[model samples]
Target chain A: MNRLLFALPVLVLLIIGGFFYRGLDLDPSAVPSAMIDRPVPDFALPALHPGKKGLSTADFGGQPKMLNVFASWCGPCRVEHPIIMRLAARADVEVLALSYKDDPQASRAWLAELGDPYRQIGVDRDGRVAIDWGVYGVPETYLVDAGGRIRYRHVGPLTAAVVAEEILPRWQALQQANQ
Target chain B: MPAAKLHAKLAVVVLIFVIGVSGGSPALAVRPDERLSDPALEARARNLSQELRCLVCQNQSIDDSDADLARDLRLVLRERLQAGDDDRAALAYIAARYGDYVLLSPPIKASTLILWTGPGVILLLGFGGIIWVRRRRPVTALPPLSAAEQARIKSLTAADQGPQ
Candidate 1:
């Protein structure tokens, strides 16, 4: 019993040390989104492009799609632009871009310069729509299955490795499940 | 006497310096336009902003953070207040959209039990350790010195006294 009592403190210390060691490997900035597996929030905002109808929650449930929150002012959005462009080129997936807290004119110019890859683009000028989506920062991407439920959320600038390793496999799984 | 008076003067100076620094006006991050005309509603909005975390900043309340998202959250809170939602309703609305992480003080729930109880448990363990140590049996007192040992000690003292 005495031996057990002495071992208890050591065991607790080891457990705490293990937890801290695990925490060291985690990215502190990456907050897990509460919206995963939940339906996208209701929103209808003005379109970024002229003469086109705006994007809405109604556009989401009918197919597997990607909702990318981005801004012209956000530097990481520029870094992830090529990966989004590549995703947009795929015939199977529909990429919807939400311009978050950016000027419409600047977003238009940015899209023109970067080569527009989005199927539909919405301008969230006041960032109200982003708040509804629980977006803390720009350059966040959400993968919405055919049922409009969010399957995955990627919180930072997407690199080629993240695209190939994390996103594509899950997207493929979502696609297969839909079919 | 002079040293004591100098110490008193130094203490007074330190106290004044501390009070001067602490009593200065706090820098508020709330923008002028976000303020409501109604003082009561504005007060409520400010209180709510203090309770909400600025998601962009590490350990900063929305009321104190200058981040754009913090400003947006403050505006949203004000809008909710203007719309006649009660304080709880406004907070719930924000919490629903932003998750429980947005609240500066998380609500007590099943998942948070560890966080709430960890310090108390550690404190109890500390008290338990002290009590156990205090209650432990001390080593038996050493047996009284034998007569031979006493005689050796007396002879050593006598020799030392003689040399002296």
Candidate 2:
């Protein structure tokens, strides 16, 4: 009993130390989405452009869609634009976008300057729709299946490697599952 | 020292104590435009916002964050309150979207079992170890108290009967 007491504190330290040590390597910025496998939240926002139809959840079905949460104000969004444009040109997926809490004119100008990649753009001017979609930051992307369920989510700028490694595999899975 | 000088020194100590106790308030970012017209509702809104995490600044609550998303969340929360949703309902509505990470106090659940019970478990282990050690100790380990020592200890512990 005396020997056990001597070792008890060390044991406790080891357990706590283990948790902290494991935590040290985890990406703190990545807050895993709770919306995985859940159906997309219902929302409809005004079009970013004059005549373009605004995006809605109803448009989520019939294709494996890539929903990119972008903003003109966000720097990383610009960094990922070329990659998103590449994804947009791909035949396998329909790329959609949400302009999160950005000025319509600025968003429009930014898209025009960069070359628009999204098939449909929704102007989430107040960001209320973004809250519904669980968007905490700009440049997040969600992959929605044909049945409109959110299959996977990637926070931060979608890199080419991320698209090729993480997204492509999931997109393929969704395609096989839907068919 | 002069009486006035002594009083001034005492005043400075008291001022420092007050400031120390206050601990500098949380930086409030709730704009004037976001405040509800109804004071009671506004108070509730303020209280509720403090419990919601600002995802941008994960450490700061939405009430204390200056982020644009935080401001938008505050507006949406107020809108929900105006629409007759209870505090829990309003919070749940947001949590449904953002998950439990947006909540300052994580909800007790299967996944968060360690988070909720770890401190209690540690405390219990500490207390249990103390009791176990106490029980395991033989009475011979402690020397028998002398009559004089026992009487002195008893008297010393008695509040009113203690030495004047």
Candidate 3:
């Protein structure tokens, strides 16, 4: 009986440790994109500015685009916004923005304070669109081809290195392929 | 009872209760500065942060911490909010920087099956042990008390009654 008591705690510790260790091997940040090489999901939302329309998946059908998911409330969004604005000037590619779980007024104000680089902004109020995009967090950017298929994903703030090294080349290749 | 005495007794009782409640939460090491003024936002931050483990602190969350890394995490959350990011986005940003280990509530996956199911598995094993113990033990009814044992019991009862 006394031996069993000692063994019981060890057994419990082993079980808990096993679970903890199991989690260490898998990267939860890398969920498989549902839009992988497939046409993007479709939806049009109220535009950020008056008298202008926002995006649906069809808008991206003929051009390679970078879809950046952001919110006015997220901090890293500020860190990554500048790079996105810089990418916007590259006439070869279009930048589509998704405003997630944010008030429209706040989003518009945020863009005004920073700079609006998005060719079109889609509002995802409930984050349903974010989920559909297989997004786990904010400031995630996806690269999509003209076919609306997702080509690449960046999990955090877009750095200069990532843009210069990876995104630009991929965008060029896709642009050339369409021509 | 005198009013002064009654007040003193109440004070003692209250002190004991305070100690009891505070002592139960020894693992709650969160500092005052780590908290927010808004109850709802603070609760949301706490709930979300607790789901994320601190990378430097290992298995502990910012909710259970007083370290510099925890302070940085708190700052990260506030920045996300000020930038117009929602709770999920802020958490994801941190997760991206530190990896999923930064999450206290791990995502559900084939690899995490043990984490999700461990408690029930342990309870089942415990119950199975109890059943095994019961089955292995012999059922022995107490033999009826012998006549001598009854006489000794009667004397003991009589001896006790003599004092009355």
lDDT, candidates in the order shown? 0.89, 0.90, 0.77
Better of 1 and 2 by DockQ: 2
| Tens-digit lDDT track of model 3 for B1-164 | 69999999999999999989888556665567767677777777767767766544555677677665565566567656657778889888776545565677777789899999989997999899889878888688999999999999999999989965
Query: Which TM-score value belongs to model 1?
Result: 0.87
Docking quality (DockQ) of candidate 1:
0.57
Best lDDT among the predictions, by candidate number: 2
**lDDT, candidate 2, A1-179, per-residue tens:** 66886897899899989999999999986787889889999899989998988999898978788899999999999999999889888887788999998999999999999999888999998888888888889889999999999989999998989999999999998899888
lDDT by residue (B1-164, candidate 2, tens digit) is 69999999999999899888997565569989899999999999999999999988889999989998889899989999999999999998888888899999999999999999999998998899778777987557668899999998887789666568
lDDT at position A110, candidate 3: 99
Model 3 complex DockQ against the native:
0.05
Q: Residues B90-153, candidate 1: write the lDDT tens digits.
A: 9888888777888888888999888888899989989998888778856678999999999999
Worst 10 residues of 1 chain B by lDDT: B131-140
The segments of candidate 1 whose C-alpha lies over 4 angstroms from its true place after superposition are A4-6, B1-23, B136-164
Summing lDDT over every window of 10 consecutive residues in candidate 2 chain B, give the lowest-scoring window.
B133-142
Ranking by TM-score: 1, 2, 3
Candidate 2, residue B160: how far the Cα is off, in Å = 41
lDDT over C-alpha atoms for residue A75 of model 2: 100
Chain B TM-score list for all models: 0.73, 0.76, 0.56
Q: Rank the candidate models, highest DockQ first.
A: 2, 1, 3
Q: Which is the leading candidate under TM-score?
A: 1
